[model samples]
Target chain A: MSALGHFLETAGIATAGISLVRENTELMRPPRALWVPFELGRPFGAPHAPAFQMRVLLSALALLDRTDGPVILEDFPDDAPESDSTASLVCPVNFPKPPNPDESDLLRAVLAETASLAPWHALFMETHGRSIATVSGLDIDAAARYAAAFLEPRSNPEPPEGRDQASTLRFAIEDLRNWRLEAITAQPGPKPSSKTLADWFWGETATGALALALHPVLLESTSPRLRQVGKGQLVPRAQQHRLG
Target chain B: MVRLSDMTADDAAHLLSKNCPSFPGEPFVAGPPLKERRVAIVTTAGLHRTTDTVFDLTDIGYRVIPGNVQAADLAMSHASVNFDRSGFQDDVNVVFPIDRLREMKAAGEIGAMADFHYSVMGAGWEPHEIEPTALEMAALLHQDNVDAALLVPV
Candidate 1:
């Protein structure tokens, strides 16, 4: 409903999202999260352009003002071409702090696994990354700090048989942004390789993007509260031959 | 579902009617469907085979063109993926391991072969256009009463 934002705001949905976005002031004036991207039919944005999309977003948020907005959708650029605001990243930017001894040891074990891998193993890993992206306000350090404060260990308790050094290095550096990095950083450890460090960093960006993109699909498959979409969710119907 | 490797198109039609979800009003009938199996796979992300043309699944997201996803395309978007992810620098989209599908079919994970594999142009903020296109093929699979479909998403 155009009333969805009003409903969420007057109710308490905005309060819930406050923690996730860390913009409490915005929460007090809850806006509806548009289900789609781009400028037209839905509140979500278009292909790559970030600023225009965010403006559309902030405008959507402004609609929450029961007293101020009669024409809640005042700024959506109906005329803007359907443009993708962001490009694919060359590498995941934004580095986090380093590792602790146990984490370092864990990194060592993962590297040991990668060191033993066969040349052909690249086949599985090449195609097996996630499709999510992240778009919250939290900086990489805040995200990392949040991670270290509350973390648990899982996966590859020991390296798999025949893992390669670099591959294992990737395994170690993977998702440090989601772990207790400050604690890890505080603890003493050997220097992680430049290669391992980079993998850890890029892996975060890749992982975040994947998380962003596949949200609907994975949620469709798994979430208990089903995500609802209108015909508004229809993807851009262009069939231009994709560039080869 | 007919398990036979080879059957007339009519039998294929009969089987699909019995198995797949029937559309409104139309009797669920089976048999030869689609122009040909001509099936392609699109991953959850944009992964490509190294030997073929490449598509990136990272920040830009996944995309599958009509032909192979080349390494050069993926490399343009993600040099790190090319240098580290691809078993070979030249081949792209190998990460999804369509080669494994080829192997699986050869080793008999199932019968027949996937004629094509696909990737998304980018990640989740945007959605995919393949669903409608798939129904065109799904109708055929439904008609033929195809045994099962295994879609691997990256």
Candidate 2:
């Protein structure tokens, strides 16, 4: 992000940026930056926080008018407001545990879980007027099937048009995960924090179990792309502690 | 919460070891006052219209997001799964902040909003690898008479 700022400033346009990582910003030394204490995905403090978002925005934009020498990295004074932890998310579906350790049973559980989440996901779409699950180019059911197919010993489901198997599997898993997260969040409650949602998805959900089960299978696959996905893309590092 | 102290050791070390390109000289261009400068957002969040192509692992190119874009029309395809996305899922303003920018424009906090904003996936390439794309976007911003750019990352 700071690199882009440097390039834009060099091109004669003044640039100011929100620095999520102050160390990186200090090293690269962009023309002007406001070092925000927010998390990685959220440069502007929190969701649904307009006043705080304005303060962060104004602080960064305020740097543009400074006539001081280049490399101004100011820190935002306050941390982002914490989410309402008292209001816990109540997951609507109660997925039964797989009957056995076999991959087929896990696949069935995941499929059933996907089917159970569909209406809530539909509610998410209805409320938000959008869904990020479109990345895989497959509907929620197809994404579930495509991802679950990977557990088969020799089955290689065809990817969507113009996509390769490894990429398709990665996206299919993302779509299912996103669909599920969106679905669960649509239940009536205060918004959950990212950590809460991640914990629910990675620690308690059947889809999470399916992903954990696939990690080894993909890591052992001959395809380098699938191996790459297994190594890093399939699961977030923060949640890797949950891996069996 | 993204401070290095808050992250796992491995994650913190990975971020510390990530490449950050340095240029020869400090180049700072003087621009108009905040309320008189045309502003645009240059994000590395891999945002695009839902109908647009998804960003590949090593895609260094950028997608143009028009100023009038709706929150529901945007989607993220960033290659990295390391970052938190639930915030963005709940509110587009958390990442894109287009509505905030619009409100700023309405309140006369800035001179004007540019007609276009730019987004690129900030992974799978070296920091210097983004220079060309940045230069291209700078030219486009110039064409739109934008004097100030707010760089956002995810």
Candidate 3:
């Protein structure tokens, strides 16, 4: 999703991802927002294979300039991505899948926690440790279950005991190039009127494998809000290229 | 021949942009041109009807249009979807053409048909997830090797 913003940034298309599941929908920083709170299964991937998961990831980047309005993408099959292999089981680490916690209880926990964000966030934090941020409704437990089912079973490679180190933490904070990002500010430009905003064109300028570089900008020049966007809303278009 | 007015809000589109990079993406790929060639359509507008069993309300987005319908009839009937200030298509299939693609085939614009059209009402938040579906579909299309593909927005 960050990649989409990058491309859009270059394209002068003011693009935003539905990222404020928790705080701001800004996918990360600078030219962000448009955030929607959902699990990876529904938002971007099925589960198991990293390859398929990434395909949908890149596809989202592709939408940077495809539509004028907010774009909601589906990653599941008929309903949601089936990571049942993971979601349905407790843990694949042990020989036989461990008896899972009750789904009814789980469902209840989910419903009861609807208004509360603490437990869910706590759970994710416990399992994954921590990250810059996490989306709402991402139920890591659900992800755990899905992971168990979706990913091919890998024998436990841990040496039984895991060690914690400051180096790891320092590396994560200081050097994770992918995770480290900057918030791109919108350049001042003409703002379009409501009527004009209604006529904006959406398209993609990003391409290639992982596509971390694509970012979509809202073009206000052709619309009514061109003035506001120019002052704020509109993102400049990227370099022109021959569209055959 | 598709007038903007002809389409109901779901039929007409205000603007269109290519998802693939312009410079890198050649008009005609080495194999068959994605145009005038048999193609498959996919949608992230998250479409599935009650009858179809692919629908998921929790999946997010509008479900007015069937996301996975073959793209044959709709292309001709509704050239564009109703325009909104910030949305692609209101009724649905905002990004995939499971319908119009089929119509083109009937009209002889395309030569063959893909076995299955893909649909996902994916609220784009992550990038890794979309990769597999694309690979799966791309591989499917490659195996089928149609002249070209027509990917319309839901």
Candidate 4:
């Protein structure tokens, strides 16, 4: 959005932005930015909180009055809604882990957990009138297999049609991540905090292990930007493996 | 409470290691005071009218959101778990705030509102993919005579 905001300014449209990831907004440095401390996807503040939302919008637009500097990142002076529910987030799904597992064992564990959550995932979709499979237009099982296939040492399969090798791989990674989260969200009672889901994916699941394993395949691609993006932009550093 | 300073040292260090764009150009000034300026909104929230084609998750392009649309008339296609859309699910004002913009217009907080707003799926891993689309959206907003814009990122 910072890039878009910059372009909008160049076109004589004064612009101000509300940011979710402060580091990202700082890097791009839009003309005027309001760094909200809210979670991603809820930039205006709490759901259904009109006064707060209006305040956020007004605060961001206030930046338009700045006449001097190239950029300003003002903090939206409000505490983020307390996420007390996140204190002890536990994903409900569990697949037995094998001791001292290899890549294939980890892959199997990931797929098994996905399959185990299929029924609950379907129920979650039913309530929302949507499914991740419907959104991506790929069967969940096929998507899992597609991602897992890349983890094998000698697979080197063709990329999905219309996408280059790196993009296809990237999409696969995201697809699996979303699926895992969907399953976790489907469990009855309070959903895990977004941070917990992220931690579990990177710290507790084989999915993260697979992503780390696939880092080399992504870097070995012909596109240097793809390498930089996959290693530098796409995956978090904790989930990224060092390249020689 | 979730300040950037609250980020773990490792996560912060890793994030700071990535390249970020720096601008040397002067900031654009509102041609007139905000009360006399025309304003609009642009979001990276993948928001669109319910009747429009939903955004492809990886799409770098944009969708047009009519300014006076209803909250029930909007839908978001972003699939990240990082955000809780319960608020947006109930009232889009929590994310897009077209209604609030309209209210602000009525209250003279801003002079006028554009007839259309803009939305793009902002989840793309590659930032370069969005440049052309952003430029195109900028041209359209310029043509619309938008004097200032409020950008919301989700």
Candidate 5:
């Protein structure tokens, strides 16, 4: 981010940016930056927080007026509002655990899970008027089937036209994960922290199990793209501990 | 919450070890006071309209987001999955902040919003590799008569 700032400022356009990683910003030394103390994905503090988001935005933009130096990096004074971590989100669906779960079993479990969560996901769309599940260009059912096809040892599913198999798999998985998260959050309850939601998805859900099962299959595949996805993209770095 | 000390050693090291290009000169062009500058958002959140193309692993190109984009129309295809996305799922303002910028314009905090904003995937390439794309975006901003760009990262 700071690097883009340097390039823009060098090109004669004034730039002010939010610095999520102060260390990185210090190295690049952008013309103007506000080092925020929030999490990685949220540079503006928190969701649905207009006033706080404004304060952060104004602080960053305010630096454009300062003529003090070529580089200015300041920190936001406060932390984001802490999420309700103590709140336990109960899964509305009761997925039956399959004994000696094989590829077919895992696929069936995932399909069942998605079918159960469909209504909740629909409710989420109705209330929120949007979803992050549109990346794959496949609806939930097709995404489930596309992702589940990877479970086969020798059969590689044909990706959507003009799309590579590896990327399609990644998008399908992301769609599934986002769809499930949206469904879970749509239930009537306190909003869970990202940590809580992650734990539930990775540690408890059938979709999580399917992803974990795909890791080795992808890593051992002949395709380098799939191997790359398996190495760092399929499972987040923070969730790698769940791998057996 | 995202302090390096709180993260796994490998994750923290990877971020810190990323190569950041250093330029010889520090160019700081002074813009008008807050209320007189035409502001635009330049984000590295891999955002684009839902109907647009998804970002590829090696894509360094950017997508143009109009000033009047709707929340439902936006989708993220950033290659990295390490960051939190639930915040964005709940509210686009968390990552995009277009709504807040609109409010600032309405309140005269800034002169006006640019007719177009920009978004690019922040991962899959070195920091220095963003120069060409940045230059192109800067030209677009200049054409739009934007004086200040609020660079947002996710």
Candidate 6:
């Protein structure tokens, strides 16, 4: 955004942006920015709350008049509100986690959950007219299999062409995450919080465990990029809020 | 709050580096005062009219949305699981806020509303891909005489 904001400013358009990540915003140093305390994908506070949304928008626009130069990072005063209820946000499908004490068990468990969710995913595609796999250009099942392949006693060491090994793992991980979210959100009810969904994925299911199990493998890779991406981005994102 | 001096070397380096911009220079000239300015919204929430093409997850490009379109007609195709979608599922004003902006204009909080707003996918990581799109959007906003823009990033 800092880059784009700078480009827009050069065109003589004044811009004030609401930022999700304080670190990224600070790095790019856009001319004007409002740093909100909301999650990564939400700049506005909450759904159905117009007054709050308006306040956020108006506050961001207010930065256009500030005398600060080059970059302005203003913190929003309010924290994001809590969700109204969990019962209201219940996901109908329940894929129980199999006992996963080791890497093999974790992989097997994740595949099992994936198998359970496949029918729901298909139904979602039928109803919504599109599938997550179609949009992401990844086969969720194939991706999971790729992750599982890492656990083989002697798996191929080569990364997919034009990409490193950890990058491949990260995309496969995201593909699996997308698949699970799609299946759960497909049911007719309020969507769960990201944390709640994460808990369900890592705790109730075996997804997070599988990712944690992959960490040593990623960290031990010969490529620096593979190790960096795994340690720096992938592991932190997937298991940042691990409770166990 | 943790003092800056107490931070580890890695944390400090990351913090200092984050303050740098690609095209570093003076800030843009602020437009007219808020009361007299024409305002518009541009979001990175992956919002679009249901009929429009959904943003590719990695698309750094943008889609123009008419300012007067019904909020109900909008849909979000954002790929990140980190965002909470319940609010958007009920009312897009939480992210797009076209209706609220109109209300502000009606009440004279701002002088007028721009004829159109814009939205772009927020998950893009590459600067080269995003820069051209931003330039294109700026040109369009310039044509509309938008004095000030409120950008909502998801």
Best by DockQ: 5
C-alpha displacement of B148 in model 1, angstroms? Answer: 5.5
Residue-wise C-alpha lDDT for candidate 5, range A1-244, written one tens digit per residue: 8888888888778999999988888888888899988888999989999999999999999998899978888999999977777767766556565644577888888888888888998899999999998898788778878887887878789988888889888988899899989999998878888889888888788888888888988999899999998998899888999887
**DockQ of all predictions against the true structure, Cα-based:** 0.01, 0.78, 0.03, 0.40, 0.80, 0.30
Q: TM-scores, in order shown? A: 0.25, 0.96, 0.27, 0.70, 0.97, 0.63
Best by lDDT: 5
Interface RMSD of 1: 22.9
Residues A1-244, candidate 3: write the lDDT tens digits. Answer: 3333333333323332322122212222323232322321123222223344334333333333343333333222222233212211111011211134233433333233222333433453354343321111123333222212211223121211231221121111111111111000011233222123221111111110001111111122233232222222112122112111
Model 5 steric clash pairs: none
Can you rank all candidates by DockQ, best first?
A: 5, 2, 4, 6, 3, 1
Across B1-154, the per-residue lDDT of candidate 3 in tens digits comes to 1122433332222112112221211111223322334444444443333233222222322223332453221211110112121111111222333333454456564555666554454432343334444445445445654333333222
lDDT of 1 by residue, A77-190 (tens): 343233222312222123232333233333333333223221223332344231111111223333232222211233222223443322222222222222212112222344
DockQ of 2: 0.78
Model 4 regions lying over 4 Å from their true place:
A1-6, A19-31, A39-42, A46-51, A62-73, A85-93, A99-108, A126-137, A216-230, A238-244, B14-27, B31-38, B44-116, B119-135
Ranking by TM-score: 5, 2, 4, 6, 3, 1
| Fnat for every candidate | 0.00, 0.78, 0.00, 0.54, 0.80, 0.49
Top model by TM-score, which number? 5
Residue A98, candidate 6: C-alpha displacement in angstroms: 5.8
lDDT, candidate 6, B19-135, per-residue tens: 344556345767787878888788878877766766644657688899888754676666454444445544566677787888888888888899988888866455546778877
- Interface RMSD score of candidate 4: 4.5
Q: Of the candidates numbered 5 and 6, which has the greater DockQ value?
A: 5
Off by over 4 Å in 2: A96-100
lDDT of 4 at A85: 53
The TM-score between candidate 6 and the true structure equals: 0.63
Candidate 5's C-alpha runs over 4 A off are A96-100
Q: Which stretches of candidate 6 lie over 4 Å from their true place?
A: A68-70, A84-193, A201-236, A239-244, B1-22, B25-27
| Model 5 chain A: worst 10 consecutive residues (lDDT sum) | A92-101
